[model samples]
Target: MNPTIKDVAKLANTSKSTVSRYLNGSPVKKETEEALKKAIKELNYHRNENARRLVRSKTQTIGIVVDSITNIFYPSIFRGIEEVAKEKGFNCVFYSMTSNKYKESYFQNLFFEGHVDGIIMISFSKRDKQELVEIAEAGFPAVVFGDSAGIPNIISVDVDNYYGIAELVRYLHRIGHEKIAYISGPEDAAATKCRLAGYLETIGQLGLKVNPSWIVTTDWSNEGGYHAMNQLLADGDFTAVVASNDETAIGALRAFQERGYHVPTNFSITGFDDITLASWVYPSLTTVKQPFMQMGMKAATELFRRMEHGEEYPSERHLLKPELIIRDSCRKISEPIATLK
Candidate 1:
């Protein structure tokens, strides 16, 4: 027996009208939305899309949900999505959630309500992933523009985080760096886990000893990078730091400069995500370039195909390549670098 809206309403302790408002993309209170989402998940409750689509019809619009608009990486990706949208004669409504879970729920509600024929999402959390999987399982047309490691149901278009980090590590080794440290993003992120695995695997292959203290954990923020670098300074010594992204790398650079360390002379740093700031910063950042625009294009293309072909359409997982952008951040060192015992 399939769950009904009444079951959802009952489990959430909210009125049927409130649940209707939520499903219809009407604004609901934050706590109410949370409760509804929880109830929906627990009960595996999905709205009657077939009946809804009979009334709404095709809108020829696709929704895009990005993690952050201000982050330099997304605009290029947006451009890519836009390009595909134009070619396919579709319109796009871009939404930036900015890490707010409730806001994400609001957008998901819009997606569920048949407002858009399809949707492309970027930077999903574990909770977001589960919800998205459920959404896809319900036969919604969707694409994720980030890691989709554990979930096979949802279509994903992502850069190769592991290969990118491996190339970065190999590049550092080639530049005569033996003692290296890594500043990682949140542990739960698939990108963080994959990049960390690459770093560990490559270093092991090269016979380099890893000091556990050298691997500092932080969020993917400049301030987090700055503080993590300071912690590294207090904890031990290393020749180079592999940052999770260009922002953190730049932040770490500032930290080292504040302590009067000359980049590449006394220390070296590298970053992933070759954002615009990477090249503009002093002693320009050596980083890995993720094909942001291509990822967007691929995601949008996959989404439209699924929308047109329905449930029988084959799912896809596109792993785009990452490029190593060499710059002035690193240097060849003759002396052996120090390490914490």
Candidate 2:
């Protein structure tokens, strides 16, 4: 038998009304929030949706959770989800993550409180992933996307991160870049891990020497990439750097220019996620294109289907492939591979 709200209340040492208010979207004290979270995590508790719907009700809206609404990659994806929701006669409510610690309670309020019928969580944190998985397993409707959710027993849509970056690394190899560094996105993100793994694995396969100092982890921000690249310039010498995203690549270019190192001349570069700025940049970024809009459309379409057909649907996992766009950022070296080594 699964844990009940009483267990949550007992373990949290809070009244049932407090837990109810917290779960039903009502604002609660931070101390109460922390207590509830600890108790829930300790007991592996999941609120039953059937019980939730018996008293409360849905508002015919789909809530979307995003890490950053201003991020370039999410606009097209949002369009796709909204377009599908519009066709299906449902409204969309977007929730930009404000505080990391309060997210679970906020989601409980957003979901268990009945403000939205279901939720689509884009770019989940590790804690977020576990909570969402528990929510789904407890019979709530959820669709995970953007990064690795790692809940094969649940519904999710994402790109093939390893394949995407591996292709980029291979392309650099084809163009004769031997010494390459990796600029990672947010350290906690699943995409960053996969891309880093791809770079390490492919370089090893090609017999390239790995420099421990060449790898840098950073937040997925333009400034973060700029500073990381600047540090790399101040320290190591490499032929190229593989940025985890287009924004980082763009910033790295700025850093390269500031130091009088011309792109494709002194330092070649690559990135993932073909944002609009990728093409507008000087030399145009040679990056991997993820199917963001298609991914959003598929996630929303499947989510609506689950709403109508049944929530007991088999977990749907969509791993879309990324396309590598070749451009002028990289140049072929005249020296033999052995000589470069």
Q: Determine which window of 10 residues in candidate 1 has minimal summed lDDT.
A: 124-133
Residue range 76-115, candidate 1, lDDT tens digits: 8889999999998999997777755645446655655658
Off by over 4 Å in 1: 1-56, 96-113, 188-190, 335-341
Whole-model lDDT values for every prediction: 0.81, 0.79
Q: Best TM-score goes to which candidate?
A: 1
Count steric clashes of candidate 2. 0
User: How high is the lDDT of residue 27 in model 2?
Assistant: 46
Candidate 2, RMSD to the unseen true structure: 8.9
Colliding residue pairs in candidate 1: none
Per model, how many backbone clashes are there? 0, 0
True-structure lDDT of candidate 1: 0.81
RMSD of 1: 9.0
